[model samples]
Target: MLHAYVLYGVAGLMLVVRGIETEQRDSRGGASWNEVITDIGNERWTDYYIRCLHPDVIRPLIRGDLPKRLQDPEFRQRVSASLNLHATPGVYLCQFHQTGHLQPGDSQETADTLEQRRGAGLTLRQWLMVVDDCRLYSDVNNPASRNLAEQIDSAYRTTRATNYASNQRRWQSGTRQQNFAGLEEFLNMMDRRWLNWARAQLGTPNEWILDVPMVRAPAVVGQSKNVTERASHHLALSGSSYVHSLISCIVKFRFAYRFDRSVWQLARVERPDHMNLCEAIFSILASAYTWELGLNQTVSGASHQAGSHALTASALNQIYQQNRDENLRLGNVDKSLMLDEQLVQRIKEIKAFDKIKDQKFAELDEREKRVVEKGRKMDTAFEALMAREMSGLIRLQHRQALEASRAAPA
Candidate 1:
């Protein structure tokens, strides 16, 4: 079962979405009913925000199966506020658009700009999570997962200050910031390891990162695969599987929350000099969220006039590009069209042929000349195709920019 995560614009919260599909196989090879730690985001939105939002359902979900360290009342309160949409919109809620999705022209109300207000009957975040505490993999035998699990666990330990009372004080004073320096390092580590796969599966690599520092272990994520179908099928998807060999690895996955700005949220010009990975990702999502909220229109003092001409939505991608901050530029644009391995190969082949076409045309024998002629024709087709592909991306950018301007409050 995959681990489901839903981030709310309320309270910068990330909630697990579902209970898993199957339980464990016993020593006798029997399946039993194991109530895994269910994710709040996995529950039906109506059920979660409605029924579960009720004191009864929420009381149990919060009080149930919590980690020993996370079993306090403060943790329950943190999760509660995090899950509440009406009260807290942390950064921006990640959701599936339902039948009732709102469009730019359709929304005349300010509340319509909120992410929590833009879903179907209820908003659902598309993700899943499974629990596996099987002592199958340990530090000695499996350092990668062991290290990751510990790191995430440690990150959680740092969030003990995320109580309702303390959070309010910090929010008002902007004085408290819980630092998980290790989490930031962990994200950089992931960038180095999964840069290629991430680019292929997700949008342009490093463009809009969900810079997950250390995913809880023994859980697989259901996501778009950019690799060959064969490679994807042959490969198991898990935190450790990508980093190291997945055989006989006992992985454990856990959850943590922070009251302060430990989780970083980043954008084009918004990248911080130092921050937790969670905070960095949250920064980008928050930028998209603010635009989604139409709050970008109200900024004053300096940037207000430019706000009229300012880019919107995920246009922060363009904003970053305009500033020429090339290495760092991830946002909410789910760019499915990737210029990866296959396309690069084609571009290189066409360029090679184009380079030699004139020289080879004069000196080559008939058979060789014929080959050169074929390559020249292929290059023509390829170059045009590449141009069109690039042009399409430019058009997409234009469209996003136009939408941003249109969505801005007049």
Candidate 2:
């Protein structure tokens, strides 16, 4: 009776697992194994292999003897679901509300219940159970399982090759810097192409900027004349939206450069080096962007305040009189102090940054000089060693010749 009950229990478990897989197929539209793995991400996968996966499961999966119960299709589906849980554990619950995880007209009560369930991320044992199942279910014909196993090996190799400490040592000795030359060249080409595209759009006749001035100058602010035409033009131009799209393009290019496998593989070992020239350039660009943003905000606020009152002739006369009175009162004020404080502060910050950058450049130059001097000393020693060895060899040859001559019959 106990054996029969055990059989029934196993069958029930299989049924539950199979049903879950069916639901996943319906929800995911039968996504391929590769797609699922990609959704997990190479970095996460690497982390799983290196730091998370159980050693017991690893050996069985490696040896092709993983338990069958662990290999059920439900475990595979859960792998991707686990990633969703890892990233957004439905902590807010409202996050899952729009995700259709809750049915139509479902109250916050229902969402809270769902969040409770979703918040429970995959634990280590559960992940190991999946691995064990895959190992047992995996065969030479099980391409999905086999592919995952292969990825584990690939991740291991990548992680080992890109070890931070080893890469740093190599970099300090100036070993792996040449590896990035090709990648740098490719990025430079990409930059030039993007620059040309941006120049075409923003320069010579100035497309978007011109559109703004052209429409706004002709239209009277208070009147509804050409209202429809002006509105349409404004909508079409998107009001400087195109001007900011360069930011997105720049961001996309940066991510593309970061994740390109070929380029990443080359420098994978060398963690992020703040002393890199590229780092300096990026910092400068970011500072400039921040300054522009502050300037724009200040101008925008001032313009809004100035434009708040209607500019009737009497209002303008009043404004002029007020400005004259203010100017007379502040006539002896230092021009520098009278300037926008934020602008002055930014200038001071920039000068400080320039000084720091110069210091760093000088330090780098001195370090290079020391490295060069060290190399020269090593070269001189090497030359002296070679000369001594050659002289000793010649002396031995001469002594052998004299001894042979003396031994010759006369």
Candidate 3:
């Protein structure tokens, strides 16, 4: 009975592992070894071999020169999903001869095969070596292989830089910045757009930000009186909602400046031509900051006058010290501010602000705690909003693509 039970348990484990493997293969659009080879054919032996050797070895190739058959709308989508699954390390490798990163082995068969195929023979090991080569020597020699290779490299570098800068800017902007979530979403969208724009711009008419206005001016803003129509036109041209949002923000700020003197002055919206999108965004932020301060001051003032409650000097000091400590921990030394000194200075400012505000709430009250809690809630909401906005923007771009197809010349 004991032996039977052990055997059954081992069988069950095998079944489970087999099931998981099957599921993964299905999800990745993977075919049986025999099926993959047959599908590729002997004439395309190099393609089959590279893919069989390691899944990732085919990615750069596919992305660079997607097989004509695979370019079918449905097929391309499925292949893209499959390619994404090869993100794991050691799962794929490039041929040593292809990437020129690793020295070729002494096997005559491998070397001859590689030479015949023009450095296309790849094993699973070679796929990994290729990725390492791409990552390490990406900046090396500019080989004139194909236009696609250059475009992919250029786009990848631009995307990486844009992502880094956008993340850094978002961190600096903090939770207090007006429409922080919207702005973050916009930044992410802009990164994707800029990458696409860069790829399209390369050796083309649509080459830069300034080129967009010059080449596609009518499409940029649209001539429609209807708001939805105008927005749709802009969406089709820009290929992104962030661009639409930017344009909308600029137009709205300009209109607002026409009537509201106070808003105009605070925003510094002097001339229509001078009103850039970044400037408009900063104006909105300034307005939001003013509103927040006013609301906080009112609440603080009421609590002090009523003598209901107040934060203790110790708790206030603790909060200030914590902010300072956080700033220090971020270590902006190259930024010219010693962590400790910056923290101390910020703490001092907060302490001074608290002293002035504490007159109304000398006893430390629920009101002050509510204010702090509100700030935390705002920060959380901002993060969530940004995520939602990004998803929405991607969806909007897809929708625009569909619309443009429907309206295409028959």
Candidate 2 vs candidate 3: the lDDT winner is 3
In order of TM-score, best first, we have: 2, 1, 3
Candidate 3: stretches off by over 4 Å: 1-240, 243-334, 337-347, 363-410
- The CA lDDT of each predicted structure is 0.29, 0.30, 0.31
The window of 10 residues in a row where model 3 has the poorest summed lDDT is: 213-222
Summarize candidate 2's per-residue lDDT along 107-191 as a digit string, tens digits: 9986775454331222222222332433322232455544543443233232222323332211223233332232233223323
Model 3, TM vs. native? 0.14
Clashing pairs in 2: 66-135, 66-136, 70-133, 71-133, 71-134
Q: Please, what are the lDDT tens digits per residue for candidate 3 over residues 290-345? A: 22112111111223223222334354345445434433454522322112333344
Ranking by lDDT: 3, 2, 1
Q: What's the true lDDT of residue 313 in model 1?
A: 23
Model 2 bad stretches (over 4 Å): 1-339, 408-410
Which structure among the candidates has the greatest TM-score? 2
Per-residue error for 324 in candidate 3, Å, reads: 10
Candidate 2 local Cα displacement, residue 177, angstroms: 42
